[model samples]
Target: MTKPTTTPAEPPYLRIVAAIRRRIADGELLAGDRVPSTRQIAREWGVALATATKALTTLRLEGLVETRPRTGTVVAGTAPPTASPALPSTPSASPVSSASSTGTAPEQELTLERIVRTGMDIADAEGLSALSMRGVAARLGVAAMSLYRYVPGKDDLVLLMADTAYGEESYPADVPEGWRPRVELGARTLWTLYRRHPWLAQLGPISRPLPLPNLMVHGEWVLSALEGHGLDPTRLFDVHVLIYSHSHGLAVHLEREAQAEAATGQSDDEWMDSRAPTLQWLAESGRFPAFTRIVGSLGDGYDLRLDALFEFGLAALLDGLTPIIEGREATSR
Candidate 1:
């Protein structure tokens, strides 16, 4: 008798891709319809966020879906290419193979710096939530297990990525004349980093700060600026926290807006426009007269310009702190 043969089970991500592909084929999901987001897929399938991301990536590669700026990922308007076999779970040996083909660099070429940089690139393009060990490995063209040889896991990799990004900027050796200018420079430098890496703002809470060496550099800059002022140690630290909070609080919205756009398939302007009816209702209700008046006064809709807001808020904060720093006020609290 011939030996019994058994087929291998499909990977979770490929299973997800097949389900979605079937929906598209059956006409249940139309070309322009928004597909389930990575989060949604994860929740529904009881799978990891990484798996969901991989499924979406596979679909995109197969030309079954495309991303739009204001709109989230939707089925491609054009016909998809001829069906292809599911991607293998492991990296393929053949150079001309499908998605699993080894990356441009061989496995031996992998280094911690290269891995961290690749992770940063992914996090830069997609929000932090989209990042995964598997995704990074796939991009690097190595097996997922190969990454463990360098960074232990995703958490450690993210920390390395954050540290590297923070280390990009440094304070000048010759400081500005006044404490205010020096403080301004430090705050602006941090803001620039946050602007470049919006995901940085989402790292941790105020109580539990990330213990990154490069982040300490920025902290040192701010503390030095406020140190010689007449304020006590407590007040000095308090003011530093306040300044840092101002930059971080505003920056939190940067990643949030990106995530929201991806999740809801709507831009800020588009989201606001969708709420027009609610706004009109609120205006006519006569309950919020001041709000209605101010909103109505604008010839064009108010544009939420974050950079302008940052500058305005920074100026106001500094002006308020001037008296405290100059010893004109008894206490900042």
Candidate 2:
């Protein structure tokens, strides 16, 4: 006697992909029309953001969707791929078994490096809040438990990811001349890393600094520049902290903005525009004349450009420190 075969249930992400695909095929979603964002999909389906992201990725792979700058994801201008009975799945063979059977290393063979890189990729795309061991496993096409073989847990994995991200940049062999230039280089380097990986700024508070080796590399650069400037050890370290905080304090908003967008599905401009009524009310209340006068002077409203602010702040900070650092040099002479 033979038993009947039962097909496996469709994955949540694929189901989302199919539903969106249907809308495109049925002409409900026209070409170049805005599609539901990942956050929207997550809310509508009660799925995790990772699942939502995967659904969109699947749609993109099928040519059903393409992302546009400032427009978010949209239906592709080109026709989507022809429909098939079902989406394809990975080979049934496990990574370990495949390696043994083929006498060659399988590409999917799990490793510490692969796990860390995948985690970093997830944190980079979505904010750190969306990152999870299960999401990393789903992205890698492996069982979640399998990750434990390489990493102890999410806490350790995040440290590894942070260290790897911090290591991406390095100082040149030919160092810049003068303490100010060196300090500036170090500060800008850290800022660049934070900009590249906004979630990095959210790692721990200033009181509990991350003890990552690559992070130490950055600290070493700044500390080396400040050394031998006739300042006491405490003062020199305080100066280093000040420089770090200047960059870090501003960079913290990068992650916050990303989180806000994900939660509200509104861009910075859109969010601010939505609050215009309140601003006008405050202006009319006349309780804050200085604020109203300054804001009303701007014809098109102010655009808060972080990059410009960073540069301006850096210049001002460096200018203020110049006298203090140089004064120490003169006193020592």
Candidate 3:
């Protein structure tokens, strides 16, 4: 008799992967079609997000799916063979070249700076949530464990990345004459940084802040602008905090919008269009008369310009502060 043949049971994650693979193979999911997100997979399959993540990771390794910033994971045109090589679980002293299976070369210049830079690039292109030690290692063609040698964990790496990003621009040595202008410049600088790195806005809460040195440099700039106005120490710090909050409050939306776009696979305008029926219902309800009237009066040229909003809010905030600062100056005089 022939030897008994036994088929191994598929793991839950592999089962999820197989379902997705079947969709792709059957032409149900075409190339460039977005794969179901981890949340979708977890909900549909009654599995944990980690399992969903692993399934996606396996699919990514097999080149079935690839992540695009603000687009989530999409099916690739060509899928890798079933036996695609996996990333090494152990750290390697020398770098491994993926381009050629046989060649291994020393990473002579692999410093902490290099690791931080790679992390920054990933965080910049994909949101911070997409970043992982293994992801960074793959980008650098290094073992995942090798990253731990330079940075202890993801938290530390993010802090380093934030510091490096903040250090990109600095206040000019020649300061603008007025406090208002100086504060405006400072706010705009911080805003520009947030615009460039949307993920940076999601890093910390206002109550508890990361004690990153370069970010502190920005605080110092804003604080220095308020110093000569004769405000009390507490008042001075409060003003600084307010100015920081003005910029930061608006900036937090940037990453959230990016995440929403990726998760929904819809751009902001597309999302708004989808909600038109609900908005129309609200308008027809007539309860929100003031809101409806203003929205109706708003011209076709009306655009939700964040930069304009920032400037308007900044000006209003500074206008409120101006009287306080000038009143203090007069009171002291």
Per-candidate Cα lDDT values, in order, are 0.81, 0.78, 0.77
What is the C-alpha lDDT profile of model 3 across 103-188, one tens digit per residue? 23235545686677667666766778989988877777677788788899999999998887777668999999988899999999
Best by TM-score: 1
Q: Positional deviation of 311 in candidate 2, in angstroms?
A: 0.7
Worst 10 residues of 3 by lDDT: 88-97
lDDT for each residue of candidate 2 in 1-333, tens digit (9 for 90 to 100): 899999999999999999999998999998878788766787899987667777877887787876543345678794333311111122322342333223233336777766776676667667788899998777667788988888899999999989988888889999888999999999999999998788899998877999999999999999999987778889888889999998899999988887776565555654565567688999999999999999999987899999999989999998988767777456556
Compose the digit string of candidate 1's lDDT tens values, residues 1-333. 999999999999999999999999999998777788776787899987667777887898898887653356778894233322222122221222322224667788777877877777667668799899999898888889999999889999999989988887889999899999999999899899888788889998767889999999999999988988778999998899999999999999988888887765545554565466688899999999999999999867799999999999999999999999888786544
Which residue pairs clash within candidate 1? 103-141
The most accurate candidate by lDDT is 1
- Clashing pairs in model 3? none
**TM-score of decoy 3:** 0.69
Residue 238's lDDT in candidate 1: 89
How far out, in Å, is residue 151 in model 3?
A: 1.1
Structural similarity to truth (TM-score) of each candidate: 0.71, 0.71, 0.69
Q: How close is candidate 2 to the true structure, as a TM-score?
A: 0.71
Q: Which stretches of candidate 1 lie over 4 Å from their true place?
A: 1-102, 331-333
**Cα lDDT for residue 167, model 1?**
86
